[model samples]
Target chain A: MKPRGWKELNPGAVITEAGSARKFKTGSWRSFKPVWIEENCIQCMMCWIYCPDMAITAKDGKRGEFNYYFCKGCGICALECPGKKGKKAIVMEEEGQ
Target chain B: MSASRVVAVTGNESVAEALRQVNPDVSAAYPITPATDIMQRFTHYVSNGKVKTEMILVESEHSAMSACIGASAAGGRVMTATSSQGLALMWEELFIASGYRLPIVMSLVNRALSAPINIHCDHSDGMGARDCGWIQLWSENAQEAYDNTIQAFRIAENMDIRLPAMVCMDGFIISHSIERMEYLDDDAVRNYVGDFKQLYPLLDIAHPVSYGPLILSDYYMEYKRAHAEVMSKVKHVVLDAASEFERISGRKYGLFEDYRLDDAEIGLVVLNSAAGTSKDVVDAFRDRGIKAGLLKPRLFRPFPYEEVGEALKHLKAVCVLDRADASGASYGPLFMEIASSVSPYSPRPVLLNKIYGLGGRDYLPGHAESVLSELAEVAATGKVRTFKEYIGVRE
Candidate 1:
């Protein structure tokens, strides 16, 4: 969005709209992305429960891919995956790789 | 004029009287010297049921100001009082209150800052917070203090100028001294300030508005610029409020009080109680054909620069006496502002700065007379021996 001038800004910078945080894309803040390995996935829903930003999308008793629009990848999903050794359900990778 | 009762009261008591008339919805304050009596008296009103204000006794000035911000955001008329260290402690929250455009009125009993640890009157406290974005109304005596405190509510709460305001009175000088002043009728004050209305009240669940949101570089400057623009409108709002107040109280007010400055060769600019002292001295100088005058600034914060400049432009020379020093700075806070006000005019008055009366030092008529004598010399010779000096200091 284009920057607004003083005349165009709201009084006292008050944001009149509720839940406006959804408009801001914070995914760019992440340097690492968590990649899900579907073959090793137990669908235990650990990542969905642990995602601080609510970035891990989930369905009825099932999990979906990371919602990068809101994800600020902290690698907590890969750390808490509980998948054994090299066959981990989630792993971290550099972005744009 | 509306019915008013004449009574002798201290500055703190007068301000408390105004508060009783205002009967703010909430008050949260932690006391400091010279200012404690104001809140103490206010709490008495609360206990005796003279006012229906909710008193929130806080642990510190910071918490007090924070609570005031909360209450003000919740669409309540809020007030508090403090001095010196108490004001310094509330520094960060002061900005937040004004940034949110809360019309919280505060009684700032001007006192000296600590370190040397003096408990006395000084401009250091109010001058320190001069740029905190709140409107400042300085008083010369107990009467002015009372009047200003009453007017502050109307000025700050005006829809076009919903900014917090601080009514400043000298610490021990005026706060403790008893003087005769009139108290406007309770109903008269109520009608004057009128009912409080808030635009996006936090208490209103029907329409929610986010306050104090984090606006990044994309819009931070615009928000600040808007804030600045609003301050530019304060001077007009203050005059409007003052005129309305005059109809009810029969007392005139202006951005700054001009005492015989109309046709003067030399003048003096001072603030708070010192202005009262200098007024008498100006009268004495005038009697002797010195053509002296004085300008006492009442609405100091969006300082009426153009008005001040126009008022003093005709004088040959002018001296700005400050009650506190700016320490490492070249001149006192008031002096810098007065200098800036007259900077645009051609063939301007010869300006001088005087730092005096720190830690409640006596601002005697002799001190004022000496400063006027110096100004007289400068006006005569069109030269200044010293641009700035400390007056009433021991050699």
Candidate 2:
């Protein structure tokens, strides 16, 4: 839909709906993406707690999946992952690879 | 036909009395000199349980306005007050409050901006915020201050003009000086102001809304245009409110007051308390058959251009007395507005600017007399010795 002009806006130009930010795919901003492996995942939830975009989600009694729709691929989750013996549970991969 | 009583009160107390009667849902306040009396008196009403207003005692003027904005956005009737520096501190949030279209009413006890730290009456504070999108009302005395404060709510919350408003009274002079004023009964005030109808309250989760969003090149201008459109509609709302208020209080009001301007050859345009002094001088000039008149603007914003232009167009000469300095401009702020308002006319009046009473200096009747005399000379000669003059300044 074509956006309305400034003169068409009501006062304050308030965004009316809740959680409308989800409709915007910020993943397009990512040049590299994080690939997760389940074997080395300890489910410490550090990635879940520290993810700025709340991209990492957790389920009961297990590690969760990354909702990349909102993530910008900052690699914070991969960098904070504590896999044993220097093995990273999450690693960055080039987009479209 | 609301029952009313006459009371002796200072301008600050008068504003407080009006606020108490309106009894807004929320009031956020930080005290400053001259303006401090307003919040102080209002606080007493809060403590005594005379009103149900949630009084938020903020640490600074910025927080005072910020809290008022939040409360207002939350669908509560909100208000606050401040003076020179306090108004300056709230400068940023002033735009935010108005841009959000929150109907917040503020009492700005006009004071001079500090360089040497003066706390006296001047137009510097109010004039500085003239473009901040708030409807501005200047009061000539305690009675007008009380009346304007009550009218501000109706003007600000009018459906077509939901912008914040500021009712300004001269600091120290009007704010502290005691004067006789007639006040409407509480029920009358409440009924006149009516209930505050909030547009998009944040607490309305059923229909959630996001305020103060980041709109870039796609729609920033549109939001500003919408704000401007609402402001342009303020004049009619102000007049309607005044007319209704007159019905209840029996005191008439207008965009500006014309005192003996009809068939006058010379006129003086001024604002606030100085207008009172100018009126006395105008009467004196009239007795001498000088045909001098005075035009005092009650509403400064949504400036009554056509009204002002037409009023002055017939005059041979007009002098604008501005209490605030426009610093380096050929004329002061009021003069600039008058100049532009009448600019389209083909044989405009020989307008002159006089900067007077800066930093609370005395604006005596003699000083006004001097300006009127000068105006008469300019009218007779059809030429001005100077475009602008600093009145009462030591040579």
Candidate 3:
């Protein structure tokens, strides 16, 4: 969609379209990234329930993937992930490392 | 024309009756002096099942205005009422209400702002909120208060001018005093102020919309400009609503009322209940062959600048009376607006500012006569001894 001019703006400064916030790429703001390890994963979906940005994606009632398009990499999902023994299901790493 | 019923009611009751007739979807208000009677009477209607409005008795004026904003944003017709301190408490939400373009109607019983705490009639409360972005309507008497309250919903809800509106009447002078006022039938009022239709309702999940977005420097100016554009269009909306109201009730209304202004050399500009007293003095002056006239402004927000300029251009001199003090400014708020409006004329009329009735001082007809006499001297000698004077003050 084309950007609106001052005259074309809404009366209440409203964004009329649903889910328009998806157009803004916020992942670029992250210096660290969350990487998921499927091997040490339990399908508890704790991270899915706790992600503030709705960045965690679930598939077929099981934990699936992270939508990096919006994830700011605050690491809440990794911190809340319940994994086996000493192995973590998710971990935050420096971007481009 | 529909037959009207006349009832003796106070200004507060008139507003409450209008609210009952409109029967908005929601109302959230707190009790405050001068304005308390309005919400109190409306609460009775709610308890008696007279209307289907959902009444929310909020904890504070801030919460009252906040609840109204929430209801209005969700596409519900909403209203509230407040006075001096109550209005001051709702200051923050007042901006949010207008910024979101919610068409919430409010009845503001004008009273003096407090340091010593006095509850009486004055313009201080309403005048203090001039820049809050809501359209303001000043009522002279009980009838005008009732009519303005009904007209306010239509004006605020107009698609081109979707902004919150306030119907203001002098606190004790009009709000407590009983007067004979004719009221339109309930069906007429309901039909005139039709259903509430919103362009972007928060409750419409099928077609969702986001309101009050956080806009940075990239788009904040554009959003403000849009709000300003809508405010500029309010004047025409108010006029259209007034004309439609006139058709049903047989009462004519305009942006400002010019009483005997034609062929007058001296003019007095005032507002609210004081205009009633000034009109009587104008008649007395006319009997003695003095060309005195009164200009009472009904719409104060989108002030009829061009019309006011044209009205005062022919007069030799004009005195602008203000019930609120601007404190430290050369002229009061009303006087400054009047001066700016008439400054473009080739031969501008000599203008004087008379700050009076502050903190609910009694403004009698004799006080108006004294100001007119001063204006007559200015008109004759073509010299203003002082640009501003305090009327009725001992020292």
Candidate 4:
């Protein structure tokens, strides 16, 4: 007399395999990580403010840092940095796991 | 595509900057308001080697789409951008690209369609191309616009769903407005979006496959029917890409985002920039003792019907707002859609249509407040229109 759950859900109704276009991911899995530069940090918060997902956060400015958990390793912060700070400051490199 | 930093720039620059970072193999685009400069920026990226992609400034949006089709067919990661009439012109081929199942991504700078010929923000342009078999995503602002373009590649390239996508942002408004957009790095975006792999290509001589083949009486309907079903299947892939993008970009780019809808008894549905305006209005009404909320549809195609329909059962009334007009119809494109989807349900909300801001008329916070007020007024009276109400039209 128990209610039906996902265990009893019909597999016929669920889409198991879609079209061939999206069967699997085609790109490399190991992407970049953005590391903030404290010296060039003006506290303008462009890195945090500009972050689409708020991956860059508001720290006490105890040296620069960015939240990489939600960070897609988008180098926008590094590219948009006003200074000539390259990978050395906001480095977007593959995390060695 | 390589460099990384925050700098001042407009929406056009934001798009160009984002695409440069994505670095498509071939960017075939025509000059159109707001979106023109993005293509121009790509030219500079090509020249400077910042983006190692080929730039082809085409004569027309039609040719631009065709060129993109060609590149995508050739197993190349291709991109193009357009607005308003340009999108309308690409209507026929739009279906072709999708039917062929090419995962080419394009940026549709949303604009009002013509008769009087106005070039400004509205869902008019993108709405018309809604069912073109492409994955349609409407962005709220320049940051969403920049991020959506990059996200489109991921959604399209996804092997489970081989279809093109239109990463739309309202023309001029988001396309021209200056904003601080977080640009994703090539490596990160590459990981998020992956690359274009043509599962069915016409160019591979060793493993040849026909694209855009003429379907006859025996299999035409079957092919078309399968196409729609394929799109439905791709829905999961879209969500997969969404989760991955959010993981990397730290943004919530989902099919729908609810604004205080959990305990609400009424719902307001909107798309594009209007959702932002509506959210503010919804907040004001909530302050004044109204149980109202907003539902913004991010993806148009593969219409998230079941998800939305089930969500609407709790509401007493619903307001469906569309930036485009489907003349002589009971409601605008969106209004009719929501109504039909909720038909079989017994306790469906009183759906009404508010067709506003055509030809890029200003959509202020007050308009949204007024809309909420009207819906409130209707529920109080137990009466709602089956026709469209043209808001902001002085005449």
Measured by lDDT, the strongest candidate is 1
Error of 3 at B348 (Å): 0.9
Candidate 3 lDDT over residue span B267-351, tens digit each: 9999999999999999999999999999999999978789889988999999999998887878899998899989999798899
Q: lDDT tens string, model 1, B10-106?
A: 9999999999999999999998999999999999999999999999999999999999999998889999999999999999999999999999999
* DockQ of structure 2: 0.70
Backbone clash tally (model 3):
0
Put the candidates in lDDT order, highest first.
1, 3, 2, 4
Candidate that beats the other on DockQ, 1 or 2, i.e. the better one? 1
Better of 1 and 3 by DockQ: 1
How much of the true A–B contact set does each candidate keep? 0.77, 0.79, 0.91, 0.00
The CAPRI class of candidate 2 is: medium
What residue runs in model 3 are displaced by over 4 Å at the alpha carbon? A31-44, A60-65, A82-84, A87-97
Per-model TM-score on C-alpha atoms:
0.96, 0.95, 0.94, 0.77
- Please tell me which predicted candidate would have the highest TM-score against the true structure: 1
Candidate 1 residues lying further than 4 Å off, grouped into runs, are A42-44, A83-88
lDDT of 3 at B298: 91
Clashing residue pairs, candidate 1? none
lDDT of 2 by residue, B69-183 (tens): 9999999999999999999999999999988889999999999998879999999999999999899999999999999999999999998879899999999889999999898
The C-alpha interface RMSD of every prediction is 1.0, 1.3, 1.0, 11.9
Q: For model 1, report DockQ.
A: 0.75
